[model samples]
Target: MKELDCLFVYPGAPAGKKNLLPIMPAGLLAMAAYLERNSVSAAIISLPSALDGEFDLPGIIRERRVKLVCIPAHWHRQAGGALRLAEQLKRAVPGVRIALGGYTASRFAAEILKEHPAVDFVVRGDGELPLLKLLGSLGTGGRSLGRVPNLAWRGKEGVTLNRTSYAAGSATLTGLGLAGLRFVLNRRLTPRRGICFEDGMFTYVQARGCADNCSACGGGRDAQRRMCGRRGVALKSPASVVRDFAELAAMGIKEIQLPLNPLPSDAYYIALLKLLMKKKLRPVLKIELCGLPSGKLLKWLGRALGPESKITIFAGSGSEKIRRLNRGRFYTNAGLMAALRLASRLGVKAWTAFTTGLPFETRRDFLATAALVRRMRREFKIGRSGVYVFSLEPGSPLFEDPEKYGVTLRRRTLKDFLAQRGKYDMGYSTACFTEREIVRNLKFLEKTAR
Candidate 1:
């Protein structure tokens, strides 16, 4: 371990439609950028996002001589695969360290430590600092094993919980050299099936996190704490923000996806848009929009964005009460209608999302949602962009306060879900809703997609 050289590997996602969802592990890129900034040599291999199939993992690790392995926990599907890789790497190199992070790792540290004994440690929060610190400790052969918040280590006595504080929003996004890291991965994965999207489009952090306390969103307060151990949304400086996007635009990435809700105000967003336009680039814009845009605002955007701008709104729930329950500042149905009317008038293809079976929702609410969807389709002629229904994510407010919403919480072992992932025809059912209702509503929603 003379060289502070490390390899960051992102665990793969559940394989499904290949073209529609080409995976690129943003975390791995972030980790690589962090390690590189510390004057350490780091390389990232995003297995899920790899163009090469799973069969190529062994060769890649061998060639890279990977010392460290970092992966997030939601990528539970890759556990078996990652474990096998860890075993091989240790045998080949004799002292490889395996680290895990992300939502899954933070929550299920015990389960992962038990299941994958090969894993050296599990990182709890924003991983850049923890990873660097852990590597520094490993490099020096120091074994104090003091508390490191957001880390769980395996030792003689099962697992040791270190109070090493989980850090987030700690580093400057621009200072990380994201552009350089992207270039590195791109070169390594060139001419492969689907590498990084090198088109005139880029997705940067308009802000690090979200402000709206939507119960189901990952960025919500309780959810963020549970997931990343952070309380508030960590936003980047505006200069950094504009600089990153301008760099991406210069790289020929025209289209950009901004944040979901509680985004920058009209002035901030408009200014950013004008700056991009001043660069003489026209790109498709996707945003997490909510509530209704005023006629004046719509007209301004329509005139400013001209023909190339497209906005995507994620309403999250059609049931206003459910929306309110989920901490969505409920836009009156009138407000939603007004937005739809604006999109229709401006000839802008607006996309909206909603969910069903929100904890305490009734049949009337479901029908009301259905009716709204149908009316919007007929009135605005907005084509189908409806998300079928709601899911009770593990860290969401709904998961935390299910009882308050008249829903009983049911926990399923990880093994049960993993067993069902590969079977396409046997679609899995989560405990958020009864199997009967999910099927029925999915059928009802099919009318809109048709």
Candidate 2:
């Protein structure tokens, strides 16, 4: 009966393990932060916490009395549960509008509209600016829903599909008055005295479109144009990044993750690290590199964070051939080891991630990956290393040209991925690797890695 504007729902950790991943929902938080600046009162419900019995999601919905409930269908694994939540919300408050967005919803908006009746609108692409416009249009009347870019909604005749659109760049984040990533959960925001790193793990979108050509990745340049409607990578100014980092660090955030492909040019990263050092930002900086880490890059990071700041660099497999095929890296194990050694000397803990099941990978390839993990653990003091199964995501390069990559497309539908959920990692075998091979590889890795 009442309208509280908008409610952003994080569908929560997918089926698999019950442990919460130590990362903030950055995309949703950015939208919520933007909406707040535009003067809209939005409530957020983190379903993972709710599912864990940390909070009651339905009660929050009733209390907020939101006009629109926005569920994120970003990851395919979240589709089924997100839609399920939308259905429940609709039943609780039938008049309320239920909308879905993010990668999964964006790619399958039309199909979701045709199949699911409870979902009202599908917000595609980036929801930061489009969300503001959608809420504004909703305030006046729901008639202008079609005018909003990157939206799929039902019309009188049938489902209306709008051309996917891209709004905002990395520079858009610089204009935010205050970073409001804290409201990712339903609990009322209590002002913390300072930055509590444990309470402040957040994903920092350093760059927009990835320049790397990782054939299996969805965030690659080709996938960006096809999926998110962006061209080349758009980066924030080095100064802007420093400002945001310093602000987050001052607030007491102990860890901050930057998602970047090779992290701009060495000069850009060098400058960022230097400025961060000057500002005395001591948070544990986690950098996800699309390729191998360079010696200079490692040195600058070491200097920037100082000796006390813990550094974690996420890299791919040790097998150069497999790394090249899976991640498009041109470096060898020697180079990676050298960089890791340098990072170790600088007190940087390298976080290596190995994907067990990938296109063109065999039992030998899996063993190679495991061997590299062990070598790193033996030679360099690795902070953590784990093997993850490669999920054939819809918009990825392998998904597009599986034949070229020597892989088969088994899971192609939204329901297919929904059926996977947590199992997408290693619980289930994919077309590339059989269940027996996966189990053998896992056992070998478990024995070797330990």
Candidate 3:
């Protein structure tokens, strides 16, 4: 058997709305592409699929002759499992270099490396390129590790750190060579089982990072700039945006998901939609656009994509008070009303999404969101739009300081959330919010949706 050069391990997290379908982690996919581009053979193994824990990872590595093991740690939820997996990989392949990279890797680098001695190198920030360089350097006779940026390692003396540099500028979506990625994952990354959409599965990004200053959001303003060392939203060039969709269509990927934060400009979105139409991509081209559309924006989208176009609007709250707290300035009830009104008139399938139990939220606040959702459904006949309860996301400000908003961190840690065995999975848990208020508000929202 041919020796496997590298084994890229994609750590899993609990999935589903009620615990629903597996979301392909784009970061791991992107890194896979980068490694393959540099002539490194990489295989992605998703731990979530090993639910019964039947997969013999050590035996597999031995069979495949694996060399390097790279695992990405996401927030607190996957950190423990990912770190454990890293230790296992180290034990399985003593010569194999184990590395950790991801959002949490960058945010809590010092602490993670100190705690996880199994991790030989910590790839901080956007790790694709640095990881590629590191792998290439290792492939040859041992070379000085001085060139690779965002690398943290411990030596004979002590720990050594390198300069911070990203795989590429976070702004350029075109920099992400999807055409290249699709080729590598063609064999390894089979279509995700039980996704929301069937026969169409592609995830593309129109923009990287966010501009919102929400103190709770991990990628909000200051944090984003500090993390990426840039200001404002960085979008993929319009042509690159369109090309990605077109490529997916060519590959028989019918539904393309664009998870752009803060959304992209009207012109960029319109241009990309027009390009997709030119290629004749079919029903349900999904995108997590940053807020409710504006009246003018809705009109433009409707005209450009036709009534059959489906778009999910992520409006976290209906109450102005709650919106103010989340720093969700993109939409107000008035703005949302206008957007929904236009969508209804144009015959577009628009879904209004809201989350409950925000920091500083009260019973009145919950009622406000429920009432607003009910009104939207009634007024616009937007039956498909509904409210989603809040879950604690570590990178968000809500997790950073839960107490400030009159909530207590009941779950305590990631382990507690993981050990849960009931209908309510981590996705729906309000670890910080009181259970009574959360249950009451969620019931109200569900009733209103019905």
Which one is best on lDDT?
A: 2
Candidates 2 and 3, the one with greater lDDT: 2
Which segments of model 2 are wrong by more than 4 Å? 1-3, 14-24, 50-65, 182-185, 188-200, 260-264, 306-315, 381-385, 424-432
lDDT of each: 0.59, 0.67, 0.63
Model 2 lDDT per residue over 1-450, tens place? 344567887765444534223232456667778887788877676654443466555666677667678888776656776788888778877777888987778777888998888999898777776777788888888778888887788888899877667656766756652465654553423222111122445557666667666766766767767666766666677778888877766656556666655333567677788777777776667766656667787888777674544444445555677777777556777776777677777766666666666666766777788778888677755435666555666678877777777765667776666565344343234455775576667667766666
Model 3 residue 277 lDDT score = 61
Say which prediction, candidate 1 or candidate 2, comes out ahead on lDDT.
Answer: 2
Estimate the TM-score of every prediction.
0.83, 0.86, 0.82
Q: Show model 1 residue runs off by greater than 4 Å.
A: 1-4, 14-21, 48-65, 75-94, 142-149, 186-202, 262-268, 290-300, 382-384, 409-413, 420-433
Task: Decide which is better by lDDT, 1 or 3.
Answer: 3
Model 2 Cα shift for residue 405 (angstroms): 1.8
Q: How close to the true structure is residue 351 of candidate 3, measured as C-alpha lDDT? A: 82
Candidate 3 lDDT by residue in tens digits, 1-450: 666776766655444323222444566666766677678777666655444554567876888777668787655455656677788778767766788876666556666667678888877666677777787777674376667787877667666777765535544336665734543322334455321122344566555567666634666655555544435666677667666656666666656666645643456666665665676644355656666555665665666564445778877777788787776455578877777777778766778777777667766777788788778767866475677765554456655555555556555444544454433333333434565567667777887887
Q: Using TM-score, give the best candidate's number.
A: 2
Model 3: per-residue Cα lDDT at residue 22: 45
Cα RMSD to native, each candidate?
Answer: 4.0, 3.8, 4.2
| Model 3 TM-score relative to the real fold | 0.82
